[model samples]
Target chain A: MSGALLADAPGVLAALAQGASAVLLGLGLLFWFAGSWPLLGRASYLTKLHYLGISDTLGSALMLLGLLLRFQREWPLLVLALLSLVVWNTIFGYVLAACSQPRRRP
Target chain B: MSRLIVIALRMLIWLLLSADPELLNVAIGLAVSLALPLPRRVRALSPGQFWRALGESVTALPQAYSQAARLLLHRRLEESVVHDEPARVGGRASSVLVFLDVFRITLTPFTIALGLEGGGRRYRVHELVFEEKER
Candidate 1:
């Protein structure tokens, strides 16, 4: 019985990983929608930019994590993508916010 | 110290991109890392300072998720304010430290570092605060 359980371990682990990947992907989608929903409202531009950071950076990061779990063999590429995406998008948001402000020598 | 970080970063990227663990590949990666031109006038950075900044940046990841959740759940926005936050490092922070500081600040949904002000001593951050009536 112990040997049989041991033999089934990989299958069980794979199933668990698959389930976790799905959950992460679902959460990422929910975040994306929730963040983007405010864009249609009358919120100020800076507020909208704040929401954009949530959607573009955090939501996408969740999705990438999901992908990383689902496709374990592609981890290196996924990691590189995750790092660049998070850093680049966050800085891009800052640039947008900075550019929107009135020019003041600092 | 900063030069070491640049080379280390380049080597990391090269290894990630190549995904090869062979000796030849590693040798070539090291060669490429050294051959690449580093930025001019990189400010001095101590190991302690570098590690601290790195740790803070990583910590911001979980903080970002929590902040995002809060922002989404609390739909009512009280107001947007541009606040000045003093730099985390001591006087004359290096560019890498500044970049990491900016990354940590802007990663969350509530705040974005507009730019550094007061002679690179403080970050001009635009922040959003949500209404706290539900609490």
Candidate 2:
């Protein structure tokens, strides 16, 4: 029993990591799809934007995290990508909202 | 000085994305970074304000998630208009503040900024769930 445990320890750890990565990826896709599903409804554009933007941001972050875990050696790039995703998404959302508003005459 | 810093930071990001530390790659990254134009006004946030905003955002995350979850579980969609007053006088500073406000509010799934109203002094938000007292 002890010999078997020692032999399989590395395999067990690898399997665990793989499982975790899969779970995170699944969750990310779920968030993305669920958020987008609301867009088809009768809600207004702003409402749809709320659901889509927030979910897309969170989804991308989660997907990146999953990839980060899977590719632990490339974490610096993944972390930077995640940061850019969140920052740019929020900024773009603001831009879209600001642009959608009717311009007031001076 | 800040513009140089910005360019340097952009170069660093470019290098990271490229993942090639070769001389040619670095030169190209530097050139590209330098070519990007800087904004007319750079209102640098003081460390204190940055820290405060970071803290507030950290605390706000859970609330945002809970609200999103509630919205997801509920079948009915209710729309309501809400007004937000700018904390500063209207100008570039106020515009930056408004942008930040929109980002913060839209981070949550329940609310979106519909438009700026009342000469950009107020924001009109469309909320998924609105309470009477909030109006």
TM-score: model 2 vs. ground truth:
0.72
- Model 2, residue A43: distance off in Å is 1.4
Expressed as tens digits, the lDDT of each residue in B64-126 for candidate 1 is: 998898888887888889999999765688988998999999998889889888777888899
The alpha-carbon deviation from the true structure for residue B94 of candidate 1, after best TM-score superposition, in angstroms, is 0.9
Model 2 misplaced regions, further than 4 Å = A1-13, B1-12, B18-37, B58-63, B88-99, B114-122, B130-135
Best by lDDT: 1
**All candidates' lDDT scores?**
0.90, 0.70
Root-mean-square deviation (CA) per prediction: 1.6, 4.4
Model 2, position A59, has a per-residue lDDT of: 76
Which prediction has the highest DockQ against the true structure? 1
- The TM-scores of all predictions, comma-separated, are 0.95, 0.72
Chain B TM for prediction 1: 0.94
What DockQ score does model 2 reach against the true complex? 0.47
**Lowest summed lDDT window (length 10), candidate 1 chain B:** B126-135
lDDT tens readout by residue for model 2, B1-135:
346556877987887788888999999998888788876777554445444555665665566666666666665665555556453435434333455566666676666666666665666665666432233
